[model samples]
Target: MANRVDTLVATSPIKCAADKFYNFFKLNMNELVKIFPLAFTGVEVLEGEEGTVGCVKRWKYIIGGIPVSATVKIEVIDDAAKSITFAVLEGDVLLLYKSFKATLTVSEGSAQWTISFEKSTILTPPPELYIPLVITICTLVDAFLLVN
Candidate 1:
């Protein structure tokens, strides 16, 4: 089977300040998960401490009636650019893809802030089947930022 890499981008507008949204993802991800339990069932730190690159977090949640969990490591954190990148080491997407990396970014706008998720996944067996989950998470993040 040939490895296919796919990049999926999902953007959404938020009412909160760009910095707040950026920091939430970069620093307070665990607290955010607690605040929005509906979006994510639970998030546990599997290795290292939070808020720094190399920290790994395992996320447990349900997707389409199926219970899924994924362990992702913080790959890059650029505070100036308001971006964070996470590499999926195991679980969920790993069943199909050989590797996956997701980068989330927050940008300021005149009236509303925007959050974008750029997911690059290397598929092993072909056809992209897991992108909707990323989009759903981005949508949830967008709504969550606007409200709280």
Candidate 2:
């Protein structure tokens, strides 16, 4: 049987401009660990350079009150569209997923997060837990940008 791919999308309204919000992730991702220590503990570039496609970054983040790390490759970056896609290469997330990809898109007044994945098994639950994390990150980033 062919594997089924599932998708989840969550959107949050933001106070910052789309380009500014997008640039924060594209150009200043490394600063996330320091800016939001409660949500992210570390962000390291394992290969390539920041904001470039094919770059690899390992992110240590908290979800469900537990710390988890994910190593992802920058698959696509569309500046005009204000979108970035990352493919999970390996990490704690792979333990429950056969494959995982995340895409973030910024619009005029909102940010959207999309997750596309295949489960390791039929019994494995979907990654709904990430919705709140995305929302929290969006809220924090928007506030930070508005202040600074």
lDDT of each candidate versus the true structure: 0.67, 0.92
lDDT of 1 by residue, 1-148 (tens): 3444556555555656888777877777786466556657889998888889999999887666677888989998889888888888889766756677777777874112222222334324432334455555555665777887
Residue 11 of model 2: what lDDT? 98
Error of 1 at 30 (Å): 1.2
Question: Candidate 2 lDDT (Cα, whole model)?
Answer: 0.92
Tell me how many clashing residue pairs each candidate has. 0, 0
lDDT of 2 by residue, 13-111 (tens): 999888999999898978778778998998889999999999999999988889999999999999989999999999999999999998999999999
